[model samples]
Target: MSLTSNIADGRKKKRRRMKSDSDISRPSPMQSHIDACVSFKDKQVAARVTSDAKMDEWFVVKVINFDEKTKKFEVLDEEAGDDEEGGVQKTYKLSASCIIPFPERNDPSGTQEFPAGRNVLAVYPETTALYKATVISTPRKRKSDSHVCKLTSNLLCAYLRGYLLEFDDDEEDGALPQRTVPFHKVVPLPEWHRQRDLCIKMRLNSEFGVLNM
Candidate 1:
């Protein structure tokens, strides 16, 4: 065999070895934590964008697709309207580290649905801790009710009519005050609250603690 032919054969063998090593080092799809939680066509969920400088900002998005091999997702941002001329919608391809699912209550069918008057825990903007609140109202597409004169001159009420939230914490005299907050800022309570409320309800039931007589 010629010397050039032998050199070419050696180079081909090295390339094959490198390819085999890469395949072995690659992580399996099942091993990815992001793939386990993500599902295509899942209900829209609130996710905080961590990849940007504004990490605290949250947006509602639906999972369009999941790349199990890459452990990434293609999400459709419902809040971000399509471009003019009805172009492509606002979508993002982000890794799990760049997104976090918000705490939300899901129905048995895996749909996130919250109705008005539902009790929830919400964090107001610039607040560090969650506060007990009730969903008084959600934003409507049409203005059904006529605007009333403000009892007090508050600039917030003048411009935007946000989500109406009634705080569970009341005054010493038992007066609960309601405040308007942006919808994205509000989220469902943690799991601990749900379990605690369940226990309290069971304890109050008549047959809960009755001894067998």
Candidate 2:
């Protein structure tokens, strides 16, 4: 994806902490966290921007300056702009709503269980960019560590305790690819968006006369 152009503009990778798998479990970096980050300054965050392709996507950005007076934040994108722009790292002026603070590690037990099949936004491995994905598995136990069980075989046992995520855009000749992402790298979609998506799906089901018992 061509990830530049303004929603006020810029991009990269970042990670933070937070977990809610009960009733509040929905989308990532909850809106409340984003709202409380009003004093955003010198912090790494994920900012949803509108790119040249006209698609909204999340990117990791650093807040270089905050105009408290105007309630606007000036974020610096680590991505050097296009050649015509002299390949300089670009910055963006964005509203608070467009900026999502990284999750905070507030869970004392550190046992947040993300349910399987939940939609989320996870960092694409080896890159800072956040993209839509789904939870394939959330740290389950193996019936047997025998080589027959992929989840229990090899060093993957402890590793499976992290998360098995399937990227939405991952497609290889009609095959879907899954990756093992650390728990910290996965986040729920914002609650609003999650509910919205749910409502849309319900509507489609209703329209097709698909009833759920």
Best by lDDT: 2
**What ranges in model 1 sit over 4 Å off?**
1-113, 141-160, 204-213
Overlapping backbone residue pairs in candidate 1 total 0
Candidate 2 lDDT over 1-213, as tens digits, reads: 343543223321211123233335663465545455555677778887654434667887889876656767889888777899999987888877677765433331443456888887777888778887888887553233455346344444533446788898699889778887766566667776677678989999897885554
lDDT of candidate 1 over 44-156, digit per residue (tens): 55554445543234466677877877777788865534466376557777776544454323211232434688776555545433466787775442132345315422332
Q: Whole-model lDDT for model 1 versus the true structure?
A: 0.58
Instruction: For each candidate in the order shown, give its overall lDDT on alpha carbons.
Output: 0.58, 0.68
Give the number of the best model, judged by TM-score: 2
Global lDDT of model 2: 0.68
Between which residue pairs do clashes occur in model 2?
6-9, 13-128, 17-103, 17-104, 27-188, 27-189, 28-188, 28-189
Worst 10 residues of 1 by lDDT: 103-112
